[model samples]
Structures are given as structure tokens and as C-alpha cells.
Target: MNASELQDIIAWMIDGARSAPTPPQMMAECSERLVRAGLPIWRVGVFVRTLHPEIYGRSFFWTHGGRVETGTVDHKILDSPEFAVSPLAPVFRQGVEVRARFDDPASARFPIVEDLRAEGATDYVAVPLINTDGFVNASTWTTRQPGGFTEEQLSAIRSIAVPLARYIEIVTLRRTASLLLDTYVGNRAGEKILGGQIRRGHADTMDAAIWLSDLRGFTALSDRLPAETVVEILNLYFDCQVSAIRANGGEVLKFMGDGLLAVFPVDDYVGDEAEVCSRVLEAARESRAGVKALQFPNGDDVERFRFGVALHLGRVLYGNIGGGDRLDFTCIGPAVNLAARLEKIASRLGRTVVASERFAGICDGGWSDLGEFPVAGFSRAARVYGLHDEISAAAN
Candidate 1:
């Protein structure tokens, strides 16, 4: 391998890596450059363990003439037998390199080595990408050439490991940030924040079918049940509501204790309000069925769970709001306030789902006008409506 070629790879890692945007692209470029540098390697892989609740890590695999491919491992993969027996275990656990010369009788015995040997690979090496924090990531290089990688080729490969680790850390950190943002905040809000909407007072009015839901009697339940039980029930409750909201194209913006706030935006300026109403209505029905079907156990019996949902159609100020140095990226306006009040009205009327007259009017049918009632905030009596069957059953 030419010394200048190795230098080119290191130069890109130190400077031009940002252009790659993602790890797979970095893997592709680095592997292709390694080949260009005259290393007799046919396969390259970089595995980065990520900080995430569900995902164990990600894999970037590059072949000599093929484009880079990517995949993810679940947390369970760490405990699997395949991972236990693989050379990556030592490389990742102890930050050491493992070499296998398929042509030699004394090489390491691992399932991956035998598989590579089957593919005509004569040499296999697993190297650790040690981060500055001392966390170890793993990578592999395999060669199908008859004589395999020489001492010079292995040395050149080792030279790039540090720089490659730096690039992988940057890329992986950005990804984990994006993932966590999308998890804690809704996807729409996450994108806006990442796109530089962090400043306070930055807001946009959006027309949406607003959704506010609350667990009925949650305060009393929390008073009696254990703290962990309260949390467990709330998670069970929100999981159903949040999943329904997201599945129906709504973004859950806030979890206000026992209540949740979400919105189905009318993205198209000329979009029909009726469509958003329909989607929110469907989500409402799904959420109702979900909680009623929940059978959470106490000690000897299932704990009863009932909830309320209020849907309204209106515009809200959606963005950052807080004092200096602290901000909350959320939605607040007349619409949300009205939704909150209607949720209370649902509880008063012993109903599972109710809507503002505006939301109910836009829907095709199935609404029963609950008549005018003086809500807490507004001066005038607001007209509320309930789904025909939901009102008939009273509360579930």
C-alpha cells in the first residue's frame, strides 16, 4: 500500500468526513479508499453501539465493488450465542484486535472465520475503534486474496482506526440525538428544533384538529396505588393514546400529568378540515377501545381504567415559549384551551369521547349535539357534541 494513499484516507477522516453525512457513506468512502491504497481487503465492516432504549447498535458493511449496506441490532442481540462466539466479543469488550489466517492451521476458531473461509477469505481481522472516552466499537477487514493481507497492509489498516473512530462517534452522536428527540418530542417538532427553531417566541399558527385526553379518576387512583403502579398505569394509558395518535397522523405534543395533548395538522393550506376531523375521530375511537380493553391487575383483580377525549378544530400557536434561557417547544392557543375545557365537560357528562361543535360539524356523521353549556373560560356557552354510541354507553 502506498504511504500517500494511507495519508489520503486519514486526511479525509480529519477534514472531509462531514460531506458523508452518515456512517454508511463514510464506510463506503473509507473502504473504497483502502482498496485504492492497495490493501488486499474485499470486505469492511464498522459496528457502532448506540445509546438508545431499544436498539443495540448499527452495522455498516462495505464490499470491494458493492455499495455500503446498513442494518441495526436489537438489545437482545448482545446476549445471543452468535455474538458470544464471534471475534467481535473480545475486540469490543477488551479493545483488542483478533486475527485469523485461514491459510494457517493455528488461526482462531470462530463461526465467522469459518464462514469467511467458505467465501475464499484467507485473512480476517477484527479491530476495536476505541473512542476518546475509552468506549470500544468494532470493525472488521477480510481479504479473499490467496496470500491474504501482509504485515504492511495490516499496519496501514490499523493506522486509520483512530480517525475512523472519531468520525463514527460524531455520526452516531448526531443520530442518537435525532432518535431521542423524535422519541421524547413528536417528529414534526423534533425536525423544527433540529432545523433551528430553538429561540423563544418563535412560533407558527397551524390549523389542526386538536386532541386533549385525560384519565378519569387518575388523581384518586394515584393516591391509593403505589407510585410505581401509578407510573405503570400511566404508561399503559399513554402508550395506547400516543400510538393511536401517531398512527392516525397526529403528533402528541405534551403529556400533562394524566392528560395528553396532540394535534392533527391540516398540512395542505387548502386541505379539508373534515379529513383531519375524520382522522382525529378515528384515533379517538381506537383510543377508547384500547383503554376499555386494558386489564391491568392490582393484587387480586384488574384495576378499572376510564378516560376522556376532546377533539376540536382550530388554529394554535405552535412553538417555543418560556423565560430567558429556558423554553418549551409546544402548542398553546384558544384551541388547546377549549379542548381542555371540553375534556372536563366529557367527565361531567360521563362520556368517553366528546368534541367541540366545530369539530363535530365537520365530520360526516355520528355526532349527537350535547347542547350549549357555559364552559369555565369562555363568556358564552359553548356547544359540545359526543359520538352517538359513546354518549349512549355513558362511560366505559
Candidate 2:
């Protein structure tokens, strides 16, 4: 490619960087521009690290006349042999450019080069991209030109590497923040935080179906099981609750040891109270059934894991709360308190699912009254109800 064409591509990349396009879009555009500049490019790949619990980073791939393809690399992938021998690992770790001429016999050392050679690729070049924070990533390009890349084509690739890295870094950091927020907080809460509802006492009162649940005899189980076994059991227990709640359109807000708090916002109600209540009850029943199906890996004669779920419907203040520097985004109100109290009541009453009078009043299914019970932090006793045999049987 000529210098004028390269300059035009560079200008496009600089403008694209400022526009904040997504990683895949940026890669696809860059690849198309490079090809249009007469570089004989056949394939392009980009990889960047991110802050995530399960994912270590993302990879983008673009082929001539093909749409961009992306894949996530799990954190565990770094330990695998596949990453150890790949060109990306060396480029990232050594912070240098790696060039492989598949046409040369010496390039057979890397299996990826051999694979490219089989695919009619003659040259491969991987460049290390260093972010402002001093972290390293990699971008690679391959060509099928008969004699590989000319001096001008190689220079074009080198010149565009910096701006490409800058644009990718911007998109990557944004994605990393979003993924961390969504993973730690629920999606709805994450959106609120990102939308700038972050000040202390920044809150809104909204009606919701409050859910509180915890394992029965978890303290005893923890004492009896090994530390690792206890952790495994807790993870299994939480999986059940999270799956059920999320499947029913509820957001899990916080986890307090063996207990979890979630809610389904009712918004303006609009005569949908019964529908909301039914969803909460269905989630409660599904969670109960899910936990009951868990099998301990150790085959010890221990009692099966059991749970107590409490459902209540009322207004709650949902927002950031805490000291100046550190804050927790969660819900707090009488409804939340009552749901927690009912969870304990369910355990005491030997019922798997318990509902407060307010929730039962709106529920579409039958419920059996469990009489009034004095609950902590309340002025008067609350009437709690349990699912009727017919409803329970159908749920099971």
C-alpha cells in the first residue's frame, strides 16, 4: 500500500477511536480498511485482557469477506498448553512483535504457523499492544500473498498498530467495567449505578415482591462438613436460588452468607399484582425443589439440604446506602424486614415456603393460614401463610 492510502486508514482509525465503537466493530472496520488499502491481508485477530470472574479476556477474528467472530477466553485457559505455544502468549509476555513466514521451514516450530501454511497463508505478524496502565495485549495479521508482505505493506501494519491499540483499549476498559458491575451487582442495579444513581442516600421508593431465603440447618451442616465441602454445598445451594429467581425475572440483590435477598419490582402495579405474586411464588417453589434434588458428593449419611423461603409485597427504598467512601446498593424497608422475619418463621414452622398476609392477598393460588406470629422489629404480630396441599402438590 502507498503512504497516502496508509495515511487515510490512520485518519479513519483516529476518528473511530474517538467515536467509541465496540471492539468487534473496530476490528472489522480496521480489517476492511487495511484490505481496501491493497495490503493483501487475509485474516486479522485481536486479543485483550479484562477484569472478570470467569472470563480472562476476549478475542476478535476477521477473515476476508467474512463477518467478525468473537470468543471469550476463560481465566483457566491461561494454564492450558494451547495458550503456552501460541504466538499471542509470547507477544504479550515478551512485549515484542512476532513474525512468522509460513513459507519458511523454520516457522514450523509453532503449530499455528503450520496450520496457516496449510491454509495457503504465507506470512503472519503479531504485535504487542501496551495500554496506558502498562498491561499488554496482542493483535495479529496474516497474508496469503505469494511473496508475503512487501516493505510498504509491513510499514503500514506497524504504523496503524498504535492507534488500533488505543481504540481497542478504550472499548475494552468500558466493557471490563460493565462486566464487573453486572457480575457483582444484579443487572438492574448495575444499570442504575452506571446511570449515575451512585450518591449516598440516592434512592427511590417502589413497590416490589421481596424475597428472602436461606438454607435450613446450614450452621449445623457447616460444622459437620469439611471446609471445602461446606463451600461446595453453599455454591450448590446458591445456584438453585439464583437460577430460579433469575428465570422468574427477579434480581438477586445481595448474599449474606447462606442467605440471599432478591426482589421483583411491581412498578405501577396496573392490575398486575396477582401476576407478580404468582411469579414470586413460582420462583420460591422452584428453588425449594431445586435444592431438594442436590446430592452430596461425599455420600455421607447427612440429612439432605433444606431451605426456607419468605415472600412479601410492599414498598421498598432501593438505592445506595452506607458511609461516604464505601456504599452498598440494596433495598431496605419494612417489606424487606418482614420477608427476612418470615424466613425464620418458616424454618420454625417446618414449612418450605412462607408468605406474609400482603403477598398471600395478591397471590392467585390457595394458601393455608399459619396464624399470627410475633416477628422481630415489628409493632404487631403478622399473619403468615403456607402453600395449600393442592398448590404444593401441583408445584412439586
Candidate 3:
């Protein structure tokens, strides 16, 4: 609190708050300095509370030092009023610093003291780190001691808050930039899809409905067009298909060029084959409409889409499937196989949509009989139906 000490503290804050190449590293440095400066505690956790970027809107665990119990800690702090909308939230939102000690019972406006008493927090201090944009990127802290932190200690921590904020801003920008470049490029797109995979046999027993559809003759179209044109056309086609699938409460698990694999779980979000079938059918209809509207580069018309759809409901494990080096998030079961087979049958039968007896029975009787057909990889002839009149009527 002396003049020279104050000058030194101001200088440190200025350096910390100045723009840096790496915000994450700055955070680490701040923690180490605070711990080394005779703070009662050595470990710290940084919690980011913000609504910017939309993706990070949820209040959850951000980061922590080696010794802090971060992810394992409960999330009740987000609603405790003391931490959530308190001086901490406002200060951080305005890019200001807030330093507080939890040991003081007199500081009733803050609940960390009571929280510690309830959850066995013996001692703690916190400083909200706000970036220039006014969003609180991280809350720095020290905790777990015999006595509570004092005002002098809190002020010392507060003095470093601005730089911590600046550090967080830089780190977030770097991470975001890297992801943007990675996802927006060609080869990197393939890599990320492969990265989020699980073992081949992992997803096998959840209540799920497999929906598979593919545009017929897409290979021939690709062959006829330039590579760049093919890429443009495919992007346009998928934008529609993916949007429709998502809107109908389905997850587009994988896109196999012209084919798409999606799933609807009755237990999870939307249930029942009839409802799921109706949704899948709606999505397919929209996709067909979307594709038919797409124009070719030559100013001549491209061919309309002819797609085959198959739906099956059963218990299936759903996750990323692959071996050691690669993975793809998709569903697996006899249901998925059967659905794919039905799609092939639809193609051969010259129909736009086909469903199994299980799916047909569950659908609105708009489905008339197409009779049984012997299909590959099945012991019995699978009864299938062409879903045309019912769906066409529904669309009208």
C-alpha cells in the first residue's frame, strides 16, 4: 500500500493488461506470480462467465491450476447470486476489476464464505478478469487455507486482474482463429470429422431409429461436371439436406458425399417410428425440393434428385465409430443395416421412399402395399412399401 509498492503494482498491471501473443499463457503466469507473492493459497481456478460467441454462453468449468478441483466441483456457483450477478458479473461485464475475500463474514453480499462453510471452503479470494470487450472471460482465485484472506491480499490480487483479462482475450482469439482456419479448409474438414470418433462396436444398444438416404446417380453427375462445379453443387445440396434433417429433429450423423446417415432417438428427444418417419419424410421432401431448384454453371438445367429412404427403429448404440486412428459419429445395429437395404430396394423398385414392415406399420396408413421382396443379408423376405401417395398428399 506504500507509494513505491503502489507504483510497482501499477507497472505490473499495465504489462499484464497490454496485448500479448498468448492469453492462456498469461493466465498461467499470473497464477504463478500470485502464489509466489506470499498469497495464502498456491492453486487457482479460472471460471469464464459470458454470453459472447453464443457457443460459450453456458456457465461451466473453464480452467484451473494443477491442484484445484475444477471439473469435479458443482455448478451451483453460477446461481448463488454472490458470484453470478454480483459485483463480479457487472465488473467483468464492464471490463473492470473486482477483488473480494470470502473469509469475512461481514461481506454478506458475497456468498463464497457461506458456500465455503457449507462446502468446506476454509479460505478464498477472487478477482474477476474482464477483457476490453466487457465480457468476463475468467475469474481468478485462491482458496483452501486455515484463515480467510485479508483486504491487503485482495487488493494485491485485484491489481493484477486487468492483465489477466487481457491474457484471456488473446488466448480466446488464438483458439478461435485456429478452429476457424481448421474447419474452413479442405483437408482439415475431413480430419475433424475423423477426430470425433469412438470404437466401431461402442454404439450398439440405445433406443434409436436409423434413417439413411442417398441421391441416385450423383456419381454420374460428378463425372459430368468439373471438380469445382461438383464441389459447389454438393455444398448447395447438403446445405438444404442438413438443414431439413436438423429441423425435423434428426441429427445428421454422417454425410457420405451423396448419401446421408441420420438418427432419431425416441428416448432422447423425439420418439416413435411413425413420428420419426413423418419427420424423415418431410426432410427428404424438402431436400428433393431444394436440390431440384439448384442451377448448373452452364446455364443449362441439372437433373432433379431421385433419392431412396429407409427407416428402422430399435435399440442401437450411437456414437463415433472407427478404429485406433480414425472415427466417425454414426449409429449401428441391425436396424441401420436393414434401413440401408430397404433404400437399395427402393432404388431398384424405382420408388422415391421405401420403409420396412416395422416402419410401414407405424406410419400413417398412407402407405399402401408394395409386397415382400427377398433382400440381401436377410434370412426372410422383407415386406416393403412405397411411400408416395400419403406423403405427397401430406405435402399438398
Candidate 4:
């Protein structure tokens, strides 16, 4: 390829990188452009490490046939033999490039080289992309040319490596931030924060079906069981509740020790009060059943697990709240307070699930009135209701 042609291709890549194109798009564009510039490129792969809890890194692949594919490498893969022996591994660890001539069978030290040779590839080049932070990523190219990549082709690949690394670093950082926010905070809250709601006093009021739940005898269990066992049981218990709530379209707001707070926004359902209330009730029922089915891994505890759930519908302040520089994105209001109070009442009344009068008024399912009770932090006593006998029995 001529210098002018290579310059044009590099310009195109810089434009794409500046515009924040996704990794896959960037890989495909660069590969296609190189092939069009008289390089015998058949496949291109770009891999970068990312900051994520569940994922170790990401890989983007582009083929000669215009197909793009992506794969996520788990943290466990770093210990695997395949990664240890791969060309990119040395590029990252040794801070050097790896060039293999697949046409020479004796040069095929890695298993991947043999596979590439079988696919009619003659040359493979893996370049180390060093970031400003001294981290090394890798971008590899494969060619089907009988003799291998020409000098000009290799030079072109080398020239684009730095800028490509810069682009991918930006993209990966953005993705890492997003994943961390979503993982630590609820999705709705994360979006709000990402959308410039960082001010400590920022808040929005919305109507929602509030849910509160806590495991029965959790305090006693923690005291009796080993600390590790208590943690295991807590995780298992929360898994049941969280899965059920999320499956029923509820966003878990916060986990407070043995208890949790969640909500199903009525506004999200177009103010469908009945539907929102029913979802919260259904989630509660499912959570109860799930807890009943859980069998502790160890035989040390044979007692059945139990919990109390309460549902209420009301308007809540949904946003940041706390002292300056330290805030929590969660719901707060009388509705949230009432849900917690009713959860305690559920335990006292020997009922697994309880619903506020406001929630029951909109729900279509049968509920048995549990009568009025004096609630803390409120002027008047609040009326609570429990699920019908048949439904409660079936849940048990």
C-alpha cells in the first residue's frame, strides 16, 4: 500500500475512535480498511482488560467474510493453560510483539498457530498496545498470503497500534464505570446518577408499590450459627427474595442486614395500580415459596427458613439523600415507613405476607383484614391485611 492510502486508512480509524465507536465496530472497520489497502488480512482480534467483577476482559474478532464476534473472558481464564500459552499472553506479560510464520510448521509453537495454518493462514502478528498507565493490551492480525505479511503491511499495523489502544482504553474505562455503577446501585438509580443527578439534594417524587421484607429468626440464627454459615444463609435467602422481586418487575433498592427494600414504580406501568400491586404481592408469594424450598448445604441446620413481607402503595421521594459528598439513592416517605412497620406486624400476627390498606384496595386478590395497629412514627394507627387462607396455605 502507498503512504497516502495508509494515511487515509489511519485517518478513518482516528475518526471512528474519536467518535467513541464500540469495540466491535472499531475492530471491523479497521480490519476491513486494512484488507482494502492491499493487505492480505483474513482475521483480526482485539483484546483488552476491563475493570469488572464478573469479567476479566473482552475480545472482539473480525473475519474476512465481514462477520464480527465477541467473547468475554472470565477471571478464571487467566489461570488456564490456553491463556498462558497464547501469543497475546507474552505480548501482555513480556511487553513485546509476537510474530509467527504459520507456513513453517516448525515455527508453530502454540496450538493456535496450528489451527491458523489449517485455515490457510501463512502469517500471524500480535502487537502489544501499551497504554499510558503501562498496561498492555493486544491486537492480532492473520493473513492468508503464501509468503506472509509484506514489510509495508507490518509497518501499517504498527503505526495504528498506539491510536487503537488509546481509543479502546477510553471505551473500556467508560464501560467499566457504567458496570460498576449498575452493579453497586439499582439500575434506575444508576441511570439517574449517570444522567447528572449527583447533587446531594436532588430528588424526584413518584408513586410506587413499596416492598419490605426480613428473614424470621435471623438474629437468633446469626448468634447460633458460625459466621461463615450465617453469611452463606443470608446470601441464599437474599437470592431468593431478589430473584423473585426482579422477576416480578421490582427494583431492589437497598439490603439492610437481614432485611431488604424494593419497589415497583407505578409510573413505569402507566399508573396501573392494580397491576403494580399484584406484581408486588406475587413477588412476596414467590419469595416465601423459594425460602421454603431452600435446603442448607450443611446438615447442621434442619429448621425451616421463614420470612415476613409487607407491600404498600404510595408516593415516595426517589433520589439522592444524605449529608454532602455522601448520599444514598433510595426511596423515602410514609409509604416506605409503613411497609417496614407492616413487615413487623406480619411476624407478630403469624402471617408470612402483609399488605397495607392502600395496597389491598387496588389489588384484585383476596386479603384478610388483620385489623388496625399502632405504628411507630405515625400519628394514627394503620390498618394491615394478610393474604387469604387458601393462598397462604398454598404458599406454605
Q: Write the per-residue lDDT of candidate 3 for residues 1-396, one digit (tens) a residue.
A: 343554454466566534323434444544555555565554455665432332432232222345323332244554655557364565545655554455555556665456545654555544566667655655645456556566676666666656555655665665555544333322222344446433554443566566788777788888888889778877777787778877887776667888877776665356655777677777767776776676555547546655666766666666556677666555676778888888887777767667778766776646767889887888999998865553432234
lDDT of 1 at 120: 81
Ranking by lDDT: 1, 2, 4, 3
RMSD of 2: 3.0
Considering every candidate listed, which one attains the maximal TM-score? 1
lDDT of 4: 0.84
Worst 10-residue lDDT window, candidate 4: 387-396
- Note the residue pairs that clash in candidate 2: none
Per-residue lDDT, model 2, residue 307, is 81
Q: Which ten residues in a row have the lowest lDDT in candidate 1?
A: 387-396
The reply for model 2, stretches above 4 Å from the true place, is: 16-20, 268-271, 297-300, 389-396
Instruction: Judge candidate 4 at residue 131 and give its lDDT.
Output: 87
State how far residue 208 of model 3 sits from its true place (Å): 2.1
| Local accuracy by lDDT, each model | 0.87, 0.85, 0.61, 0.84
> Can you give the TM-score per candidate against the true fold?
0.92, 0.92, 0.52, 0.90
Q: Better model by TM-score, 3 or 4? A: 4
